[model samples]
Target: MKKILNPCFLAGIIAVFSLTACRDDKMEETTPDQVQTANAKPEQPNPSEKSCSYVDSNWSWSAVLINTLPTTTDTNFMNSQMVNIAKMWGKSTPTLLFVNDPVSPGSTYNAASYKTGYRIYYGYAIYNDAKAKGGDIVNAMILAHEYGHQLQYAYNLPTVKENTGRSIDLEADGFAGYYLRRPNGYNKTDFSQIAAAYEFAQSIGDYQTTNPGHHGTPAQRRSAVRLGFLIGQYDVTAKDFDTTFFAYYNGVLDGSLKMVDNTIRPEIKAYLDQYVDELKKIQSGEISAEEFKNLK
Candidate 1:
């Protein structure tokens, strides 16, 4: 299980802003040593013995994931989330890769591969700060989200528009949302904390939705995550996922999406109906400032 640690805490926190600028697409070529080490996927540790190990060094950035969260009991919650998602798709674990990219440290997530398996480099700085802030839900969500990209790499799921980058990212967000709400996740925790973490993560959504690599507009991302959670709440399966994902996610982006009211799938919509009102409240800003502050 992942362990929790004290992060590089910062004070006077403001609402987290999503970094939205699009940079040049040029990628640095991977070195031979990196190619060899990053290509190897470690054996999946027994869940009971999984824990986070911190390796401190001089660098511009880093991603430090703890085994446990102070606010929840989901041990190694990050690893567990990715493993569960892989099982759902009938795939093996991808190597968890870390690197320092001066080009776009703000743009931390990317999936790479080798002959054996895949690897993921999480932006160290952003991830570290998030972890310090008790962003366990967000941390697990980010891991699963990146793994969703690994899924795209494996299955070559049709992208929204290949060069535009919207379809791939939106789908990945959908994938992350898909697992976050599952019973297998940060289990035995309160929904309020989940919501808090979800919001914390959302605060990082980029404002420039038009950028080719822009993940999604903030609102679109929020909807994507909510959609993912809704699926898990209703026990939706992967085999029948695409049809449902496209219809629901499109409505969300176009501003035509309403909680459970406009959902086209009867059975799944029925399962999510209870949260419709609460969701609408969040979307509409009905919750008071004091109320939101009490969440953690």
Candidate 2:
């Protein structure tokens, strides 16, 4: 499991503008019927049906089993959603497991993808927490992000110049954004709800730019997803989407592609203005390290 935090809270004037931008997009307003149909709750899976069984003990990737199990309803729902996303990539569905324990201490969320046959292990705490925040769409987004890693495994994508994992992580964020905005996936036409759910993505942003495993900062992460969402405006296959995302993403990393001007998206700028200074402090090691870990 990876230890990650949630997006910073948008407050006061910034919160109003940020929330409104997310809520007021014209695209979201045009598809109320489809949104209702796509997001309708599914019948809970029966617990007696046995949702998951152990596949192998010596698999390339494995973890200690948590004592708790997800309810049949949750397991079935997650599996169904995984199937939907896999179809988007024209690949067979990957195995999904719901774990009870955290991957480590002081972490309420932990999820990992084993490249061997594209397996995913999600902690129950994270699953329940995502559902609580924004219904199943949030849960779907989390699963989609993990599946993004599987796509990397399948395609061997994102040839990175930097040794850090930020490139891979940000690409996965883009993949999730692409799927979330698609009609057959989450069918979330409104960019605002997608932006709101991105709070989860923002929270997981890390300030450890020098760390080999560092993911991008909150602002960078948000920008990546937004780029993906914009690209998703067109109908593109998964491979094509990767090509497009990498073209822009590589530019951002190599200092060739200019970063999107946040002034145009006032709401995003509002949130970033509030957090960027603190993030800089964390990155420079000027503040106590715990502050970065404890970001909420």
Candidate 3:
């Protein structure tokens, strides 16, 4: 059955997750020579020792995945992207820990294990499904989406006030969309590939009404992705990106009062022009409410 999440509870859930499970204050960078055991939960590193993982491999995101995507080629691209994105928020070398559970209990698509940098399980099984349905381009979208969360950590973006189901989840989805449209990494100028990934990710947000902590409903999730995509059509620094992101996001969660039509940021405005019509169509319900479901 479809689930509808109250915005407030979703905000609380974010806080609760932070307070109970997340260890943001404790995360430290890994050093080059330090070969810590994969599962060994180490204390947060000191200032000089912070290191980002630079895995090298044929494995798509094995560089970021703790043990699952192990490969020989250094995956500095992930580290580079994280570093570049984090710099905007004044963070350096945030630890990227990996959890090995095939089916991580709490949330899927990986989340920060508290303030300890970023935790990405990248479960092969999960990626397999995403690949089968969405393809590699779509998978790239997913990776970028998860990295967006890392940006949130480095910058200390305001946690949602209410832990309801919709706001936080949608915001993250929006963030993912925002990055996909950027030129640096994926360089996806068009929305088609990103949209498919967005839809694929949202479909897994299936839960009954009783699952209070479930992600947003399918419609809300789609809106979030569309919003992100709309924002992506323009170029902005990480600083500008976060500021605009939170402003628009808070506006979306609070009410319709946060509408923005200004193209004053000439560059952003120019980029957004490409997506204006598509955004309007989405806002107008041009897209069907299709969802992807996890096979039993």
Best by lDDT: 2
53-135 per-residue lDDT for model 3 (tens digits)? 22211111112235223222223444455554444335454554333222221112233323343543343333444556876
RMSD of each: 12.0, 15.7, 11.8
Q: How far is candidate 1 from the true structure (C-alpha RMSD, Å)?
A: 12.0
- Judging by TM-score, tell me the better candidate of 2 and 3: 2
Ranking by lDDT: 2, 1, 3
Reference-based lDDT, each prediction: 0.47, 0.55, 0.44
C-alpha positional error of residue 296 in candidate 1 after TM-score superposition, expressed in Å: 16
In terms of TM-score, which candidate is stronger, 1 or 3? 1
- In model 3, the worst 10-residue window by lDDT is 7-16
| Candidate 1 lDDT over residue span 1-296, tens digit each | 01112222222111113222211111322101111111122233232322322211111122222222222343355456657767766778765533333332332222232222365544444455556566666667666766666666665563245454556566766677677666665452334545655564455455555655455555556656666666665555453454456655555465344343343468876665554544444444564534533432
After superposing candidate 3 on the true structure, give the runs of residues whose Cα lies further than 4 Å from its correct spot. 1-66, 70-114, 158-160, 206-212, 246-257, 260-286, 289-296
